[model samples]
Target: MAAAVTASMQPKSMTRAKKWDEVVENAYRFQLAGYRDEEEYRSVKKVDSAEKWDNGFVKKLQRKDGCFYYYNKARECSDKDVPKTKLYNY
Candidate 1:
């Protein structure tokens, strides 16, 4: 099941993203929702996957409080935010 896969994907070490890219963008999205990444998000939210756009960017996310957050079609993660985004290694 999805839960088993997510559990196996847990990170062993983490580091801040040095540049802006798809991976950093995803990390930014997850961190904004108070999660480490997609795996953590799925585990906490109990969802199969985060809703994404046609361009493959995160489209919507629900926080722990049950509030939903929507993202724009454009890139949400900027150069200034790159240093704040964490990249996880399994």
Candidate 2:
């Protein structure tokens, strides 16, 4: 019981990062096509509570219109419309 509790309490250090990377990578690959079920993974990104930093957070792609880039400013996803390109060029 104690071991189980201890294990559960351990930080999920890489889990989130791994998931984030996967989402980004898939989005980068599929872009707007990911949304229409033309691609495998669903088009998804962090749209809310995005933060701005020294380097600035990159905006996500995969718009609802099948065209245009994500509208993001000051680390916040301001685009009322969905984006259709990768946050960064890979």
lDDT of 2: 0.33
Clashes of each: 0, 5
lDDT of 2 by residue, 1-90 (tens): 123223333334322112234344333334333441212222133244222223444344444444544434342322332243233221
Best by lDDT: 1
The most accurate candidate by TM-score is 1
**Candidate 1: what lDDT?**
0.84
Stretches of candidate 1 off by over 4 Å are: 1-9
Candidate 2: list runs displaced more than 4 Å: 1-54, 77-90
What value does the lDDT take at residue 69 in candidate 1?
85
**Predicted candidate 1 versus true structure: per-residue lDDT over 1-90, tens digit per residue:** 335445577789999888888878878998898777888788777789999988888999988778988999789988898998889998
For every model shown, what is its TM-score relative to the native structure? 0.86, 0.19
